[model samples]
Target: MIRFDRVSKRYPPGLDALSDLSFEVAEREMAIVSGHSGAGKSTLLKLIAAVEKPTGGAVLVGGQNVGGLARSALPYLRRRIGMVFQDQKLLFDRSVFENVLLPLSIAGFPPRDAAQRVRAALDKVGLATREKALPIMLSGGEQQRLAIARAVVGRPNLLLADEPTAHLDRDTAADVARIFHQFHDVGVTILIATYAGELFPGARRLRLDHGKLMA
Candidate 1:
């Protein structure tokens, strides 16, 4: 769950990314954030992930104030969060399996356990057959699915996606949206920042404009 109370983020030279933003996302709930470029969508996600500190007020995830979290405790906090970015951020030189295995490796899971988790994640994203393939060899849609697999391989409780379907065609975007729904059905709290929010019908909508929440 995420809660923000009058949160404001201002960079040097007085640029405000978010101003007095307040919202709450309950456990196991799915919500979509819509905004234009420079509308603070990504900044909102970064605040929840503890990647950026707020200039005022607070950001709390799972009941702990993220801004108050110690640097030493960040890894622990992040272990409960899964993030997918628009860029996919894949390493072309690595195989799909290796890419999905990075997080588990960082968390020190045993080799055999991590291998099992990697395969399960691939299977969930319909990429089990491509585990040995390179990211460059896949289609855009497949590459995005691989990124999703990598994010969920750790079985995070909260999933945050920033423009997950930004580059795909309508059908592919729908496919990606279904994948997110599958995870949500299984109790993963999901918050997606997207310009193509029509893909997520019936979900709670949060719109931001010029760093402020819109009514």
Candidate 2:
């Protein structure tokens, strides 16, 4: 559901984050973008999310060109895609339930339906009981799970994760990996950007070096 056609992102002063990067991620397929630090993996994710636009060529999602999407339409585009980052980025003052409900709330979902979906998302992430607790009270692993819950609470069509398991012990890292697989199993198209072989042990690998995608 994602297509990058000769996409390149350039910053000021002779720096290119990605150059001529091209790939297609079919609907419902889970793929990992593996690379070392400063290798453009995060840039790719940002391009797909429309947080940043390609300086050349196009970024297409579900057949719509996102490279030049108007600022007014960004929220609409974001609603269809969920993103999880290394840091949970949770609001410490809000209850976990409220944080998960934020997306639905922004979309104008009714309170009753929003609560139901929030609970379901928390359950999916194995954080049902912690819904009433603040983020600071949770462990790093639990905080990450809470982030996952927030990302998927809207049943988004695409999920983009960046270094989701960067923190935590091996077991908790495995738990995060399992959660990604579960989302994939349920037909959510997921693109995860992480270090080589970090979370996706058996999945197909796409290596990014410097700024170019290589086989």
Candidate 3:
């Protein structure tokens, strides 16, 4: 569950990334945010994740005000949310299994349980057989699946994906979309910011223009 109330984000030199934005995403729902470049899609996700704070109004996640969250509390907040960033941000030098395992290790999950969860995540993304391979060894779509596996290994409640299918061919993108649909079917709230929104025809649509919500 995420709610934004009159939120505005002003960067250095007073550039407004989002202006007077207000929206709500209910639990267990999937939504697609569509806009051209510079429409604040990424910034909106950053606000929910507490990587950036709004200059005005508030961003609330699961009823906790993210804008006012203490730095000490950020890790706790993030544990319940999974993010697939635009760049994929993989640990290229690490094995695929290690990349998926890193978050559990950091969160202090027990070794045995973490290992099981890592394997399950890979299976969900259809990457079970490639766990020992380095990221560089995978194809583009497989790498994207690897990123999704890493994001969900912790069983997060909310999944935020920024441009997940941007690089893939249509069929591969559709395959990736099916993976996300599987997670959503199991009750993970999904929010995707994408240029290829036709992949998610049934998701609630939120369009933006020039940093503001559009009708």
Candidate 4:
């Protein structure tokens, strides 16, 4: 569903974040991006999300060139992709349900429909009972699950997670991976950027080194 053709991005201060990175992620395929620090894995994810544009080449999603999308269309493109991060990125002030509903709210979905979707997403992430809780009140794993719920509440076609299991314990990391797999089983394309190979043994591994992909 996503392809990068000879893409490269270099910052102004002479730092090359990514170099000649080309890869394709098929629909419904779950893959892990593996690399050490400064290996360009996070840079790749940012490019896919359009948080930053490429300095060269193209980033194609479902045949549309995201690199060339109009500014007015960027939000629509991002709504089709869900992203989770190591920090969870939850708002301390909002209830879990409210946090999950932010995307729907931004899209101007009606209140009732947005609430229903939020509840469903929470249920999918096994956090149905925790909807009214605050982020500061939940455990680390629960907070991470909340992040996943927020990401998938939009029913995105592609899910990108960066260091998703970084702060969790072994069993919790395994649980989170299983949750991601469940999303994959039902047809969401999953691409995870992680350094923990042992945590994702069955996933297709794409190794990155020094801003370049390695075999």
Alpha carbon lDDT at 163, candidate 3: 96
Per-residue lDDT for 89 in model 2? 76
**Highest TM-score against the true fold, candidate:** 3
> Each candidate's lDDT (Cα)?
0.95, 0.91, 0.95, 0.91
Candidate 1 collision pairs: none
TM-score of each prediction:
0.98, 0.97, 0.99, 0.97
Off by over 4 Å in 1: none
User: Which residue segments of model 4 deviate by more than 4 Å?
Assistant: none
The lowest-lDDT stretch of 10 consecutive residues in candidate 3 is 201-210
Measured with C-alpha atoms, the lDDT of residue 111 in candidate 3 is: 98
Q: Estimate, for each residue in 116-159, the C-alpha lDDT of model 1 and write its tens digit.
A: 99999999999999999999999999999999999999999999
- lDDT string for model 4 (52-76, tens) is 8999999998888888888899999
Error of 4 at 208 (Å): 0.5
Clashing pairs in 2: none
Which stretches in model 3 have alpha-carbon errors above 4 Å?
Answer: none
Q: How does residue 161 of candidate 3 score in lDDT?
A: 96
lDDT (Cα, 0-100) at 90 in candidate 1: 96
Error of 4 at 11 (Å): 0.9
The full ranking of all candidates by lDDT, starting with the best, is 1, 3, 2, 4
Among all windows of 10 consecutive residues in model 4, the one with the lowest summed lDDT is: 195-204
